[model samples]
Target: MGYWSSVLLVFLGSCSYGVLSTFVKLAYQAGFLPGEVSGSQMFFAMVFMWGVALLFSRRKVRGKQWLTLAGTGLATGLTGILYYQSLQYVPASIAIVLLFQFTWIGVIIESFIERRRPGVEKVAALVLLATGTLLAGGVLAGEFGSLHPVGILFGLLSAVTYALFIIFSGRVGHEISPYTRSAVMLTGSVLITFIVYPPSFLLNGALTEGLLVYALPLALFGGVIPTLFFTLGVPHVGGGLATILSAAELPMAVFMSSVVLHEKVSLLQWLGVVIILVGIAVPELSHKHRTAAVRDRG
Candidate 1:
């Protein structure tokens, strides 16, 4: 695929993720706890992805690759748990903002692993992202005052776990096909969620009528489609660009909430969104330019 085509696919996949939160909220309002919704979604996602994999690829799935997928799934599942728990104590907007700190986390982790620091552009992007998050989350005005300390802690932990997922997924990209990778990750998530909250499925009677209806769409959109896309696109996009594209989810969430949930968006939040976009875009554009320049020189 062409570079721009890959970039567009990544962008679309990330935007899909961005709009997913509202569906999650709808599921929650329907009386589904985070564990139940997330667990069920992954379970169904695995089934769907496996079906696709079986249809398309005759390649044998390897044992070590399965292990790597499990590890990735575990990381992905833990991040979900942390994020969902954080949502219980904080606003979705704030929780999302905290989760997106993964961009900086990715940069720092890459720096340590690669034994080289990020360039000036990356540093500036990180700073802008931090500032934009503060503004977008309304933390600057102490809006997070309502959030529990434990929730905040989990939010940060989610970012760390999520960053780890990005790193590990990138490393394992060469070893497995995207479909196989997605299936394994989903299977891992299923195991963890079931083990951690075994009773979630058993408590179906406790859920509202509304939640049952919501889960079907939520699982399809939030869990299945996006995971398939991420699995397919991330390997092509690279983790850093993937992270930046995924940040698009925040603005999408905000826009969706405003339209669907009728939530009010403040001026500062809009400004923050613009700033965050610029922060993410700058690095991507710079990288593309540098790549083109190198090609020209050669």
Candidate 2:
């Protein structure tokens, strides 16, 4: 696949994740607890992914590869668990801003792994992304109320785990089929989720009691689409660029909140969304221009 195509996949994957907060909020309003909401989503996602893997994945995964992908899923599962927990204490706006910290965290992780400093384009993009997140998250709009310390902790930890996920999702189990890889990794995620929040939703009939509606969408957007897309795209795009592309999620989340949740998005927030889109484009546009220039010289 072309590099641009891979970048598009990652973009779509991150956007899919951006839609999850709306559905999660809906589930909460419907009276489902956080454990129930997260647990059910992972449960359904694990089952569906394994089904797809059985039908489509042909490559046999080695034991070590299985272990590695499963371990990586720890980050995946914790990201949701922690971020959701954070929302309980802080407003969604604050929680999202906290989660958006993954933008820089991801860049830092890539720098450490690659043993090099970030290029000027990435640094500039991070600045734009940070500025945009503050605006879009309404932090500068005076959205702050009484901020809970525990919520802030969960939100920041979620950023660290999410950054780890972006970095490792591209690095591990390269030879395994994306289908099989997503399944194994999701299995690991489900285990962590279940351990953290027991599977009481199963016996409590939450699935039959309206949680299934929310769970299905959550599983589709949060679990399946992002997992498979990241598995397919992140390796080709590399973690740094993929991290920048993943900023697409924040603007998307803002759009979803306004449209679905009927939240009032101020004009400044819209400006922030525009800035974020530009930030997402910076590295890609820079690379494309450089490539065209090199070709002209040749």
The TM-score of predicted model 1 comes to 0.91
What stretches of model 1 exceed 4 Å from their correct place?
173-175, 202-212
User: lDDT per residue, candidate 1, 124-219, as tens digits?
Assistant: 887887788888888778788867899899989988988777666667746566777777777887788778767455456643445546656655
TM per prediction:
0.91, 0.97
User: What overall lDDT goes with each candidate model?
Assistant: 0.74, 0.90
Q: What is the lDDT of residue 228 in candidate 2?
A: 93
Clashing pairs in 1: none
RMSD of 2: 1.1
User: Pick by TM-score: which candidate is best?
Assistant: 2
* Candidate 2 local lDDT, 122-158, one digit each (tens): 9999999998988897878677656888998999999
Model 2 lDDT on a 0 to 1 scale: 0.90
lDDT of 1 at 271: 85
